[model samples]
Every structure is written in C-alpha cells, then in structure tokens.
Target chain A: MEFQGFRRKDGSVGTRNTIGILSTVVCANEVADDISRHVEGATAFMHQQGCCQTPVDIARVNETLIGLGKNPNLAAVLLVSLGCESTAVGEVAKAISEAGKRVETIVIQEVGGAAKSIAEGTLLVQDMVQEASRLERTSCPVRDLVLGLKCGSSDTTSGLAPNPALGIASDLLIEAGGTSILGEVTEFIGAEHLLALHARDEDVGKQILDLVKRMENRAKSAGQDIRGGQPTGGNIKGGLTTIEEKSLGAIAKAGTAPIQAVYEYGIAPQVKGLVVMDSPGREPEILTGLAAAGCTVIAFTTGRGAPQGFPFVPVIKITGNKVTWDKLRDHMDMDVSSVMEGEETLPDAGKRIFREILQVASGMLTKAEISGYTKAMDIYTVGPVI
Target chain B: MKNDAIMIHEKDNVATALRDIKPNEKVVVGTGDKSSVIQVQQPIPYGHKFAVRDIPGGEDILKYGEVMGRATQDIAGGTHAHIHNIESLRGRGDLER
Candidate 1:
C-alpha cells in the first residue's frame, strides 16, 4: 500500500511538510509561538523543560527536542533557546541537521530580549516555510509509516468497538510492514500478562512486565492508588468499573501483532511491527512522546471524545459511542459505532479505519487539525521543575 | 431491532446494555447463536454492565473473558454490576503492607 507523502532526506516519509519552530526552554516559548504564528506553513513545539533541578531531566529535554526536530513532518526546524538554559541547544541543532533537515537557532538572551528574538525567529521561520513549500508529495509505501496508537475518554463501548476496530487497523498496518507504537504503561496494570503473551521473545515479555510494575510503583510511592486517577470520572460515568477493565479494553488497540521491542519515553523504535514506548496516558505528554518517537500520523480512539492533536503530526480521532459521535461531530474523524450495533463486523470496521488512515497520511486534514485544537503539548520528565 | 445488551465473550458473566434498559425488561443479550434473554432486575443505564448470571460476593468478575475485578457483594443475575459492587484487585496501595 502506498500514500502520497513528503519523502525526507533521512528516508522518513512525512504526512505533513511544515516548518517547526521549537522552543528549547519554557522561557523561549512565547518567542517560538510568535514566530510560528506569523508563518503560514510553520508550527511551534513549546514545552516546559530545558532548565530544571536534575541532570536526568535536562538530558531528557535535549534528547526529546532532537527527536522532535528529526521528525519527518517538519521540513525544516528553527529552535528558540534561552542562552542560560541547561538544554544542549548546539548539540540538538547539530543532531537535527545530521538527520538531513535544515536547522537554525535563535537565543532569546543573546538576541537582547523577547521582542528582538521573535523578530529574528519569525524571519528564520518564514524562510524555512518557503523552503518547505517547495517539497511536493510523492508516493510512499506503507512501510515508511510509523503509526502511534492511543485511547482516551474511554467508555464500555471502547473495548467492544473502536478499540478492537483500531486493533485490526494496527494489525493491518503491521501486516503491511509498517510500525505501530503502543504506550500508556499505566493502563497495562491487569492486562500486562496478556500483552506479554504477544512479545517477540522472553526478554521482551519481561520488559513489558517491568514497565507495568514500574508505572504502578510510581503511583504507589505517592501513597495513593492508581485507580484513584485512572478510569477517570468520565470513564466511570461511561460505565468502566475498574482500571483492570479499562486496561483489558485499552490493550485491544494494540491489535494482535507481536511486540517487537520496547523503548523509553520519546525514543524512536528500531524495529518495525508493533512496539511499546514508555509514556503516561495523558493526552499532552503521550501525544508529544509519540511525535518525538518519529510518528508521522497518530490514531487516537476515544469513546467520550478527545479533541487534541499534535502541531505537526495529524491525529485522527475515532470513536465507537454513537452519542458522542452525534454530540461531538466537530471533533470526531471517523465512527465505528456500527460494530456495536452488529451492523458491521470488526474486520469491516477495521478496513474502513485503515482506509481513513491512508487518506489522512496522504495529506487529508483531521478534524483536530482543521479546528486548530492541538496546542496542549508537553515533555514528560521524571524530576520536578526547579 | 438491535440487541439490548452485548456479551463480549461467552465466559463473561456480565453483559453491557446497548441501550437504557428498565426494571423487569426482558433484555436480549448478545446476538445470533451467542445470545440469551434475561429479565433485568433493575434499571441498567446505557453502556453499563449487568450480571448475566448470579455472582457471589468476593468472586471474580469476568469481562472479555478476563478477570476485571471482584464483586464486593453478591450480585443477583440481571442486576447492575459496577463500582458500587466491584473493586479492582490491582494497583491498590491501600492494600499494601
């Protein structure tokens, strides 16, 4: 299978060819945002990181920024940095340039102030946007696609309908020699055992189990139950009784593909097929993590309607709740509620979703993208901000 | 007409109501060869679960043919089964010693 995409020099295929105005620290966000806001073909990645207490988190911020810059969706990148921040701005720009993308840097402190920084950044972004506009879509095989799977605002129908349907779509993509990433380690509590059964080897299976154990311990260390926050109020009101139930349902999005490998937060996968990335289930963190992992497109299944998208990668919103489909039509991209009605089989629904994915990959804008509802983004860090 | 409820797996003792079902309503759960009719004992809201068979207290509640949690109290067949009567067995820090 093939879709029209922007073929990057690094051999990655981009569904959207846009310039990225990335902020290296929280202090440079306004400047980066202003730069992207003034450019038509530019998007900004603003996050609250780069300066913090721990060396671990600062390193993570630098690595994540490099990954984000390497993403094929960005034809070129302009990094906004605060000169005093701990983020390795030079290394990040060098790494992205090494990935075969044009990269420029603007230091807020060195530029004399925010106003001057934005002015300089805007001109840089405008040039990048012009460079990006010259790239035309070309036919790219499905194998070049890296798909990210996520489910949120779940209800009971999630397990039975959209999730399983998405699972089928994931399976189809994998069968086509594409890659799909499954994150949300916290949602694997009771179902980790079942998921481990799909691992490529004993070591991979053990890794999956360890991720779940570590995620559970993080909550337990805080002297609280994970269930207190998981299976959120909307999930409960939508008929999910326990986190176990939600986990069982959520794993359905992974489909039946073999788990090839596991990766840390924001790390790109080395192997194809279905892989696991360590990330929480929150929209902001997970979406950013997926984007950093080099995913050009994301499939988000929501039973109660989640509207967030990434600035560059197009997030396709799908749902299985008919009521949510009717009420939140503006947010949803596809509906597989017919699976619940028994009018459409799982495989048929899966095929339909697969087609939608191909269309979106070929440059069709998702509702979230069209509505510009994609600003809630953040980098996941283990340490507290200083 | 659409089935009133759905049983994901044959081993599942609970069925999810496809629509709002009222007390004493004879809800047809599942579809085709895998379906059965049960007299609902209480109002089951849309998307909520109801015990398709009687479940004893502290017994495992099955869904998608896996243990989702344990019932807090004996739940009669055809009645609602939810957080009020079911508790997750995993990730419970309060249970840690």
Candidate 2:
C-alpha cells in the first residue's frame, strides 16, 4: 500500500512537512512560541528540562533535543537557546545538520533580548516554512509508516474490548510491513513475561524482562507500593481493581506479533515489527518520548476518555464503551463499542481502525488535531531540578 | 438478556454486569439446563461485578477470568463486589510505611 508523503533530504519519509521552532530550555519558550506564532506551518517544542541537572541527565536532554530535530516529520528546525543552559546546543545542532536537515539557531543573550531573538527566529522560521511549503507529497510505501500505541484512563471495557481491538489493528500494521511501537514500560509490570514470550530472540526476551524489572526497581526505590499507584482512582471507578488486572488488559494492545526490538525512551526502533520503548506511565512524558522517537502518528485506546495530544503528532482516540463514545465523541476518533455489542468481530474492527490510520497518514486531521489538543507533553528525567 | 453478567471463566464466582442493574432487578444465571433467577440486592453500576455464588473472606475474587483481588468480607449471591468488600493486594507497598 502506498500513500502520499513528503520526502526529506535525509532519506526519510514525512507524513507532514512542518517547520519546528524548538526551545532549548523553559526560559526560552516564550521566544520560541512568539517566533512560531509569526510563521505559518511552524510549531514550537517547548519543555521544562533544558538546564539544571546532573551530567547523565543533561546528556539525555541533549539526545532528546537532537532526536526531535532529526524526526522525519520536520522539514527544518530552528533551535532557540537561552545562551546559558547546560544542554549541549552545539552537539544537537551538529547532529540535526548531519541528519541532512536545514538547522538554524538563535540565542536570546546573544541577540540582545527575548524580543530581538524572537525577531531573528521568526525570520528564520518564515523562510523555512516557505521552503517546507514548496515540498510536494510523493508516493511512500506503507512500510515507511511508524505507529505509536498508547492507552490511558483505562476501564473494564479496556481489558475486554478496546485494547484487544487495538491489538488486532497492530497486527494488521505489522503484517503490512509497517512498524508499531508499544510504549509505557511502567504499565508492562506484571505482563512483561507474557510479552517476552513474543520477543524475536532469547536475548531480546531477556531485555524486555530487564526493562520491566528496572521500572519495578524505580517504584521500589520510591518506597511506595506499586499497587497503590497502579489503577488510578479513575480505573477503580471504571471497575479495574489492581495493576495485575490493568497489566493483563494493557498487554492485549501489543497484539500477537513477534517482538522485534527493545529501545530506550525517545530512540527510534532498530527493527521493523512491533518494538517496545522503555518509558514512564505518564501520558505526557511517554508521548514526548514517542514523538522524539520519530513516530508520525499515535493510536491511543481509552475507555474513560482522554482529550490530549502532543504538539506535532496526530493522536487518534478509540474507545469501546458506548458511554464514553457518546460523551466524548468530539474528542474520540473511532468507536469500537460494537465489539461489546457483538456487531463487529475483532478482525472487522481492526480493519476499520487500520483504514482510519491510513486516512490520518494521508492528511485526514484527527479530532485532537482539529480541536487543538496540543497541551500535555514534556521530556522525562531521573535527576533533581537544579 | 437476563444472564448478561458473565462468569468469564469456571473459577470465577462473580460475574461482570453488562448494564446498569437497579435494585430488585431480575437476573438469571448459568445456561438453559441449570439457570436460575435472582433479584439484584442493590443498584449495580455498569461493568461492576456481582456474586454468582457465595464467597467467604480471604478468597480471591475473579474477573476477566483472573484473580483481581481478595474478598475482605463474606458476600452472598447477587451482592456487589467492590472496594468496600474486597481488598486489593496486587503490587508492592511503599517502603516508607
């Protein structure tokens, strides 16, 4: 299957040709936002973590910035720096430029002030957007598509209907030679063993288990019972009583495909099929990791309704509860409640969802995209602030 | 339609209610050969569970064909199974405590 996509100079295919105004630190966000507001087709990557951290944490921050700049969705990148952060801006710029994209930079201190930096950044962004706009979509194979899977606000219907239906959709994508990423390592706690059985090799299986154990150790270090934090209050209200229960349901989203590889947070998958990304359970942070990993679109399953989207990627929401569908129809993209009604078989529902993914990849805007659901997203870190 | 609540598996003594069931609503259990009707003891929310058979304290409560938690108190047939009556013991507790 082939769809129209923008071809990047770096030999990557982009579903969208966007110019990004990336802020190096939270202090530089206002300037970046101002610059983006002045340029059509420009979006800002604003976050809270570009400074004040340990060396390892700082390097992670640098890697994430470089990853976002290298994302195939971006046609060009403009780095807006505050001139005094700990982030290695030079290294990030070098990496993006080496990836074959036009990279521009501006420092607030060097440019005299926020107003001056915004002016310089806006001019750079406008020129980039004009170039980005000139790029035409060309035929790209389905294998070029990378899909990110996420779920939040889970309910009883999630385990029984929605997540499993998503699994079917995932299987279809993998069969078509497309890549699907199952993230949120924290949610894979009790279900890691089940997923490990599908790994490509024994070593990969061990790595999958290792990621799960690492997450458990993090929770244990915090000295809180993981169950107390497992099914949030919302899950309990929606009939989920424990993390084990949630994990069983969550694993259903991975489908039956063999696990191809395991990747660190915000790192692109090395092999084609279904891959796991080591990430936190928080939706915003995990979504940030996914976007940095170069995912062009996100398929999110929810039973209790979540109206959140990252800055650049389109989030397609699916639900299996007729109640949530009716209540959040504006925010939701597809309804698999028919699964519960037995009106649609699992494969039939998966086909419908796969069709929707194709349409979104070809530029059919999602409800989140249309309603401006671009708020909850930030880089995750393991160190203290300042 | 009366047996909308399903056991999920043979080990489960509680069944998940498919719809909002009001107190005193008529409900039937099991297949045609041995099915029986009983009145709902209280209003059960959609997706919540109700006892299909008698359950004693410390016994595991099953849902989605797996153990969800343990019963904190005895529950008679048709009684709602929830936090008030069940204890969730699935993950590690805070070390600080």
Best by TM-score: 1
TM-scores across all candidates? 0.98, 0.93
Q: In order, what DockQ does each candidate have? A: 0.75, 0.46
Q: Indicate which candidate wins on lDDT.
A: 1
Q: What local lDDT score does residue A58 receive in model 2, on the 0 to 100 scale? A: 87
Q: How big is the positional error of residue A382 in model 1, measured in Å on the Cα after superposition?
A: 1.6
All candidates' chain B TM-scores are: 0.94, 0.78
Which digits, one per residue and each the tens of the lDDT, describe model 2 over residues B1-97?
5355555666677776777888888875543235557667888888777887789989988765666678889988888887778775534646445
RMSD of 2: 2.5
Tell me the spans in candidate 2 whose CA falls farther than 4 Å from its real position: B1-3, B28-39, B95-97
Candidate 1 displacement at residue A251 in angstroms: 0.7
**Rounded to one decimal, what is candidate 1's iRMSD?**
1.3
lDDT of each: 0.92, 0.82
Which digits, one per residue and each the tens of the lDDT, describe model 2 over residues A1-386?
88788888877777778887888888888998888778778888888888888887888888888988988889999999999999889999999899898999999999999888888888888899887898898888888888999998888788777788889988988898989998888777767778899999999999999998888777777667665467788888987766766777888888999998899888988778899998887787888888888888889999899888777788899999899999997899999988776578888888898888888888888898787677546788888887
lDDT of 1 by residue, A1-386 (tens): 89999999988999999998889998888888888778898888888788864999988888899999999999999999989999999999999999899999999888899899888888888888887888899999999999999999999989989999999999999999999999999899889999999999999999999999998888677666566588788999999999999999999999999999999999999988999999999998999999999999999999999889899999999999999999998899999999888889999999999999999999999999888888768898988877
> Candidate 1 has which clashing residue pairs, if any?
none
DockQ, prediction 1: 0.75
